[model samples]
Target: MEFELWYLLLVPVLFGAGWFSRSFDIKEKKSVADETQTLYKGLDLLLDNKKDQALNSLVNLAKIDPDTVELHFALGTLYRKRGDYDRAVKIHNHLYNRADLSKKERARALFSLGQDYLKAGLWDRAEDSFRKTADLESDYKVRAIKELVNIYESEKEWLKAIDEAHILEKVTGETYPSRISHLYCELTLQCMFFKKFDEAAHYLQQAIHADPNNKRALIMQGTMLQKQGKLDEAVEVWKQVGKISPEYETLVVASVADTLLKAGKDADAVRYLESVAEKGINSDSVDAAVDWICKIEGPENALEFLRRYLSQKKSLIGFKRLTDLRLAQDPDNKELKELSDFLKNQIDKTVRYKCNKCGFVTKSFQWQCPGCRNWDSFAPVRSEDPSRI
Candidate 1:
């Protein structure tokens, strides 16, 4: 019995001795071989979609050799990509809580945890995780600030959003002037809604300072001035909008006209509106001009001006206005009635707005494109009568 067992052991021992020369150690080679085999088996299980088995193997390996930070990270990231967020969270959380982890490894784990929380829509948890990561001062600082900014915006915490946006601008060296202006504008609107006029005014000034060409701020400022019974000042402020962003004249037109009328300068208002119309902006400008003309010059002169303008330039809003005007007068005029009906149908057939970013056309104007989810991407453009484009 002893001789038989010795022969069995001798067979394996001789094979091992032959592979390990006199100068090399046999134990070190066997350890490496065992590690390689374990890794291959774990990878094969994972490839075969046996995630639970692969995880068990990795956990056992981790218990035996706690230094496999790379393997742990790979497994954690794979779990995240596979939508096993809870398991991913557990793995990353374990790594992050390890006192022996290197600073870089800890930061990576914390970032991964934050991303997992974000994916889970636990904004508060994600924010807390990211705040700790901020202390690590990793290269992910800018990315963390950007994520925090998004979180704050989503939560409607405008103050926090403003702070984060400033930090991101400093870190990334990329200007966010328009976005900063929008943040201030959001705060301003919030304040105004609560009748905190002083706070609203301060925020509006900050918004204009952040983006001098912010038409929304100009419009709000003009409205505030008009509400305070400073019609002249309001009109002057509204006029500034046209100088700064000629394309947004339509946005401030109604406000400017009302303020001018209140200030007893209807003629001056009419002149400005007509000037913008002559520049061939959106048809809304022509419609605004027509409104002023009807108010200041009587129906006959307004009709004649509109007819002459329509003969020179074509637009849906202009046509709509002309149709309404014609139908309002001489109701028995069959030719004018027929023309109004035709123009109304044509106007109804055209899309009124388009996304500048993706060229998505829609009938309603949206500040954000529903398709691409970009802010201020929608612009009013002339919709060709199918035959025209």
Candidate 2:
């Protein structure tokens, strides 16, 4: 019984040696009591709203009792929460450099230091600190990795961003297809700017592999082919965008038609535009398509096509288009032409593309919402009056 009791008592003593006072003596016991009293006083000061005094007391306690790792962390956290990143970094750096800290405590201190650096806009130092904080068993491992990923993204290190994106997906079991795909698209942009068509195509393919439904990747691929003077191939590649995201047709239609025209496929372009209209089109896109038709097939043919379409489905937009076309054909009629121009301007002001994610309105289509950074968040069909020019 004596041995068992001594063993039980010995465990806490050993734990305390690691956790608090390292020596089991009268001097160390008194030191522990003094430290405890100081901590209590600091808490009292904090409760009384004497923030500076409380922090000073806590700092003194940390200096006297280097074993009080948790106290240092709390102080650093308080500093960081109060936006005093310099002070937080100093406290965490002190704790981080201590030789006696447990691995988890060290990780915590390092993470705190990284956060200080991050908040201070010290990206390079923050990356280094976060890297040190990464431990498989530590609670901050995933968070550190994610911070590193965000750093890579902010720095535009697309390849490193892609690597972390994979790690994050595996660790969280949530695929970041769009994010991964976009990173590849960014790479493709760089390669294209350098006139490395093959390299750009490879990145576009990687993007497609990452997310088959990534319309931007497809769009980039088409752009790459067009850059290579493969107009037919470019048009074919761009047509895939409509299949992947039908709502994005408005964005891709002009490119596809232009590509078809360059490839001597004017009839194909007209048929493609007609097929697009068959599905549905906003007033602006339809008007733009009619402009294309007037240029390619002739204004008379464009007018007849618009008349037939408006007969089946009438909208204010189509009506406005009809009046404009009629007025253009009879430009000598000054009063009628003036009325058409007035109505067209009114329609232009009222019809707008709006971001469904953030309600940001623009006159032009945005593949990614500028306000919210969300892709395909703008409704395809809703052309409400724009909030901007």
Candidate 3:
């Protein structure tokens, strides 16, 4: 009877232990499920325009799951956008320094840190960051190298820029011919500034070889040749600029014409400028035509050309130029003086140049746009102003 009683009491004790174990298991699973749901809700908040609350929730998630690399990346990007470079740097730096990071993740972190330093204008730090990223043999390495090129260009480290460009081309299979040519041009200019004409000429040749159509190189080469008293060779080289990029030809025509004139090629100068003026009434082209006409054809013929040109084109600048020419031809003509005054006021308020990329207008020309920071964004506007393209 005592044995039976003990068995009955043990049954209840075992049943109670089983129930406790099941309850603990359920509670533990519910806790994990709740944490997962909270993380999902945080992502929802980020998508729903509640960034502050979303960030707070994400911070909580980070605290709970500190090993989540994706969450860290998102947080770091957000901090970077918020202009908290220090925090972004800290997160990315932490990820980069982690021994547990995969090669891919480490590369990503390095790239991000490099961009962070770039935005902060810490060029030295940025260069170091990008250099480390460039060493990693990953998909991001090519991009890292490009960023490094941009950094070196900004810092005026042209040699480093050229090296990075070469690396980028080798790795990415993309041609940076124009950019490479520009780099060589910059190097040439640097050499020229120090009166190293031989080195400058070598760099200019390299620039031309990099991009045969690089007009800047042709212009510089022509100037160099002229300085060396090889006037005929210089004139021939400068003339090619017009054939290659006719749109930009207007720039070189006048300078080339002047050189031709000084070299006793007066007929060639007149013929070239006239043909250029007939095709485009742009400021550069028209100015060249006017300069030639005033010198050879007399002020009267120049004024006549301006009038005939304006009759077809109707440019405000052309009108202004004509008005000036008319006033100069007949200083006592009251009507000409009055017209010039009115046109000058109109021209003064006009936005002469605009960026093709960002549509930012400027009164003066800018090679690199102040608004978008794009190189060669501005083109000398002619009569039919580019409203948009």
Candidate 4:
């Protein structure tokens, strides 16, 4: 009778245990289903271009699964994309400092933290992070080196930038001749700033050797020659730019004209400038040629030259010059003054230097695009239509 009573008690105990196990399985499956549903909802929101909503949805999901490493990375990236660098740094820093993370995951977190620092203008921290990331054995090594190169360039550490650039070239199997050449030119300019002519010459040679087709280096060479009182040599060097790149010929026209004029070669200056204007009838070349013509000849002759040039090319700048001369000759003409004013407004609206890489427009020319950080991406010509750009 005691054995039968014990057996009955054991049966209730076993039944209770089975009931608890079944309940736990159902709850676990529900939790997993909720997580999956939230993930898919977030992805759908992202696909719908609702980034803010998607971010919110993922943030809630992350709250439930605090140990989700990839989810944290996604959150960090979203924060960075939204320009919330503080949160981005927080998320990635937490990930990077986690003791349980794999080496590759830690490397990725550090690289992302470096990017956040970079975008926040925290240069020292960014450099340190990237340096550490580069030391890690991971796929981010090349990217880390590239960031280091950018930082070095920004800080004017030309030697360091050159070294990193060489590493990038070797690793990527892609030559960075233009970028290296520009760095050398920067070194040359720095040397010249302190009147270190010999050092400047050496660096300039390095620049040319890095990229023989570097127009800025050639231009600087001419300027250096002119500074050394070698007018003929300067003129010769500047003229070579026209041969190498005719589109860039206008860049040297003013320098050539000034050098020739300094040497009492007024007629040669006029002839050379006129030829440049004839070759390229853009605003810069035309305005340059007209100014010199007005000084050497008379306003009437300049006006006459504009008339003929406008007949062939039909440039708005050339027409504006024509109206200006006409108004000067007869200042009382209201019609002419109004026409000039209208043209000036129109030119101001349209005239700008545009970057081909990023379509960044600026009033002045830049060697490197601020929008894309690309070198030599801006065409030398002034764009007359922003729409086309």
Lowest lDDT 10-mer window, candidate 3? 380-389
lDDT of 1 by residue, 1-389 (tens): 34665678887888888776653666667766777778888899989988878877776666666678888897787777778899889989999989999888888899889999998888999999887876568876777887788788778899998998898888779988877888899899999889998999999999999998877788888888888998888888888977876777777777787777778887887787667667756677667777877887777767776777788887767777887787788788888888887876776676357787887777776655777756668654546555422
Using lDDT as the yardstick, the better of models 1 and 3 is 3
Task: Please give the clash total of every predicted structure, in order.
Answer: 0, 1, 0, 0
Instruction: Flag regions of model 3 displaced more than 4 Å.
Output: 1-54, 281-283, 330-342, 345-349, 357-389
Which residue ranges in model 2 land beyond 4 Å of their true spot? 1-83, 95-105, 298-389
Q: Per-residue CA lDDT of candidate 2, range 1-389, in tens? A: 34565678888878978765544466778888888989999999989988888888888898888666788788988788778988899989998889888888888888889999999999999999888776445988889988988888778798998998798888778888887898899888888789887888888899999988888888887887787798888887788877876776766788888888888888899998777766655555566677788888888877887887777776667777778778888889898787777776866777777887788878777656777766567766546454423
Measured against the true structure, the TM-scores of the candidates, in listed sequence, are 0.73, 0.67, 0.85, 0.90
lDDT of each: 0.79, 0.80, 0.82, 0.89
RMSD of each: 6.7, 9.3, 3.6, 3.0
Overlapping backbone residue pairs in candidate 4 total: 0
lDDT of 3 at 347: 69
Best by lDDT: 4
Model 1, CA-based lDDT? 0.79
Better of 3 and 4 by TM-score: 4
